[model samples]
Target: MTTNAELAARFEEFADLLEADDVEYKPRAYRRAAENILAHPVPIAEAVESGDEDAIDDIEGVGDAISSKIVEYVETGKIEELEELRAELPVDIADLTRVEGVGPKTVGVLYRELGIETLDDLEAAAEAGEIQEVKGFGAKTEQNILENIDFARTVGQRHLVGEARPLADDVLAYLEGIAGVERCEVAGSIRRWRETIGDVDVLAATDEPDAVVDDFLAWDSIDDEIESGPAKASVRVGEMRVDLRLVVPGEFGSALQYFTGSKGHNVRLRNYAIDRGMKLNEYGAFDVSELEADPDADPQHVGGGQRVGERVAGETEESMYDALGLPWIPPEIREDRGEIDAAEAGALPDLVTEADVRGDLHTHTEWSDGNNSIEEMVAAAENRGYEYYGVADHAQGPGVVGGMGLSEAEILDQVDEIRAIDDEYDVHVFAGIEANVDAEGAIGLSDEVVDALDLIVASPHSALDQDAETAGERLIRAIENPAIDVLGHPSGRLLNEREGLAIDAGALGEAAAANDTALEVNANPRRLDLWGSAVQAAIDEEAKIAIDTDAHRPATLEFVRWGVHTARRGWAEPNDVVNTWELPDLESFLH
Candidate 1:
């Protein structure tokens, strides 16, 4: 069976190939269609299998042409047009594009000029100095590719949480509906909302483990069963690996807690328990003060042997932590980084929730590369009951793609349009611009352009290969620019795509705090820049943060939740995020 991920991947490849062929318009169309399909709540393949041809129409960006392709792949496991494209330009577009400076156009050039088709081929051509022989290719560009080839090859093994979570949700929903399964939930780093996931780990509570395992093995979305047993199973669903573990209902909570761990957290907690003459493990917390414990036991195993003493708690996760005389630590903050100590001192933060955000400060529309219009994107924000929304389209500067930025005249016209719509609905629409920060940390927006907007989100778009000190200084200078309201995607990194820049988070935080600029936790999964650890550093400096989605369309507007979770992982509270404040407070911060 084709999972949503599998179906979406085909279209992504379709888009890449189309872009490489220099096909205009259709590539963006295919990419948007692919995005909608990937984010669709249900499995489109299963809907097609059920003979619902209209399933494709239900997806927002998909139209007749893309719909037929979806149906074809679902029915026959092949897209004929995609196959033809592959035959025409037989290069590994995905792998080649993974290199830092390489893109679809680069792939096309290399494949045509140097007959490079794979990472090995690209590497060979670069090593033999054949790449530089091609026009438009230089020593620096070839060296850049050679440097990034191996890194790109190694990073593909992991999946992004944005891609894997939907699959995990589908799996959990499926297992919950199966007979004899009482409770089901996701586990592992996915549970912690980590940016990248190794695999989806799920746990099931059941009285009949064998029955539940059998039903899970029969899941229609599964592509291959890696292994199976009465209470455990592993399966391959598309490119993601899923491991399911079953425990009796009596130990469900403990099992959930055990599986949802950052190894450091579990180890720290177990040692804390040991210091108290107690034991903690997957089986549950135990009061083993009176029992003989072995010091020579394997240090790698938590509590050594499971169920070794009088079981204090196992039925509920809260109880397990209660047994340790501490409050339950949130999974996001359970990365050992002083969380156990914080819990002991009753100093755990009240992490910000998704509902707390009042608006998104950085977003896009048809004025830039975004698919939607400003009116349409604003409608989406109002639909979510946002008190305010910011329309920050791209401004022409360095790294602004293909003149997809607003000129000064365009900025003035957009401000007029935004003012006309500010109170048109129940929301406040703030006119904004996402200005590109140049190599020397200058935002190219003129005084007239900056004065015309209510917000400015300055972001680094190019020169991402600077040393740590250079990057930190560049970002600090940008942050100090009085006209800039938010610093966007601090590192500019794209998960599994590129290691964008090397930034010192602590120094950036200091600069941002001193300048009263809010650091952005860009919610876009591929670029969750100012990731958890960085956010924490910013928080330590008492610098404000904005959990903006950097949304390019309506569907992506909801990606703010990913940002909220990343902030939680950073120990951020409602007060730390400017958008989480009331409308008046947010407006004051903007001013």
Candidate 2:
């Protein structure tokens, strides 16, 4: 299958080739094809297997030539032209392209001129002042290359969600506060809540592009300025480069549509537009004929164009969708994941909202590894206007052998302690234990101890070293226990650290649904376990989800924002989320 990452990488490589070769128009075509393929809802290989070359042809920006390339790649697992291009410039295209201010042309030039095959070699050459000896390469360019090499190495390969997410939030908040900004969104892979990020891309709708660009360039946190233009600006915020683009209100939807993509999604949408005799661009959708309007026409800041097949019509994202005969796709589901089919069938799920979360079902306290006191945790939940808060501290038995988990006696004591603190807040607080699931699929907490707690969360804390089938069976049995209310952080993943337990989430989700147990989409950026895909699977089985912060501190409780984003990414809706249910309704589900 032409995965989103594979397609995006190919298209970007093509773009770099175009720049290196200084090929005009053709690069955009390839990029557009890449974008559409990235956003395509179904697997491209499936579409290819169906012998529907029109599937490739339908993407906007993909003319017959690009379509033929796609067909060729799918048919033979190789693209002839791309292969030839690779043969001509056989260096690691992506690695070389990663250098700051360096593109394909520079890579080719350096590779050909100095035999610079590696970053080490490039650095050595720069230090020896050999790079400046090459045409078009100046001292400044050499210095920039050296500076970027360290940045590239330090950034490693991937930016953790925990680290990149805050930076994104800071940028989004700054953008939102700016004047003339109507709607703002963080686009690209970041928006998809992908595990890692390379660069951050933001798109905003503003009436004044000039003012918006000025404000963006002046952002206080920005360490360096890259480029600022009418439609787009790039800046280096710390080590991460942030790109911001402005679009008018009319073009907001289309621009958002174009920018908030997996690239494949955009290509697919573009194709859809083409099939409908319309043209889709970053600005908006236009009748294919309207795009032919004076090639020398001045680029305006307006949103969309008016005119559909010679008859003048409206221009707007809503109208664009109407023109295309489909509905607007939510940005989260824009990864080309069955969204088009949902749009065609009008079967998109009513996604869950923050308001639906009436209570927080999983949280920690100072008694365990949590940094916050029980009172503080409850108070924070009350501050958020939650009706109830479940305090599921770690139980000291089973797999929680060495951690801050409480002993069975300690748990019984905490229940009474929790009851004692209950009168201090208006919100009801339930005492629970996050019991470990042993290798045999039995919870560490005794039945008597489990029965005493208001909420019980079963999770795998030890034997994470188990195989997929063992781990899956272990969780299934644990989840099947009527005493368990929610399955916590199913995968146990730690950002950039642990990979957690391996299991078939589909089977676990079915077991959870059968047992009427909710699955936890751990809100911690590091572990967003029961990730979007897993959550989607759970939802498909008619199982409910609990979007919990799994907070260790009061501040960490705010990790709920990321958790909510996780659920949203999974296409979870109010009804599908257990926390969204009212306290009484939720309590009823407790066995």
- Taking all chains together, each candidate's TM-score versus the true structure is 0.96, 0.67
Residue range 1-591, candidate 2, lDDT tens digits: 333335545666777666666577577556646645544444465567788777766654567777777677666757778877777766666666656566677887888899886678788999999999999989988887776676555545776565566677778988999997888888788877776688888888888999889988777566578988887899876457788988777667666666667787777776776666566666566665444434354222112354233322223446656667787676667767777778878887787776767888788887886656888889988998988899998987555523678888889988998999998889999998888777787876677887788999888776665679888878898888889899999977654445567778778888988998999999876688878878887888888888988876565666777788788878898988888887788889987
| Local distance difference test scores for all models | 0.88, 0.74
lDDT of the structure predicted as candidate 1: 0.88
Tell me the spans in candidate 2 whose CA falls farther than 4 Å from its real position. Answer: 1-156, 173-184, 205-215, 228-230, 247-250, 289-316, 397-402
Number of the top-ranking candidate, with lDDT as the measure: 1
Worst 10 residues of 1 by lDDT: 297-306
**What is candidate 1's TM-score against the reference?**
0.96
Residue 494's lDDT within candidate 1 is 88
lDDT of 1 by residue, 124-189 (tens): 999998998899989988888888889899877788888888888889889989989989889999
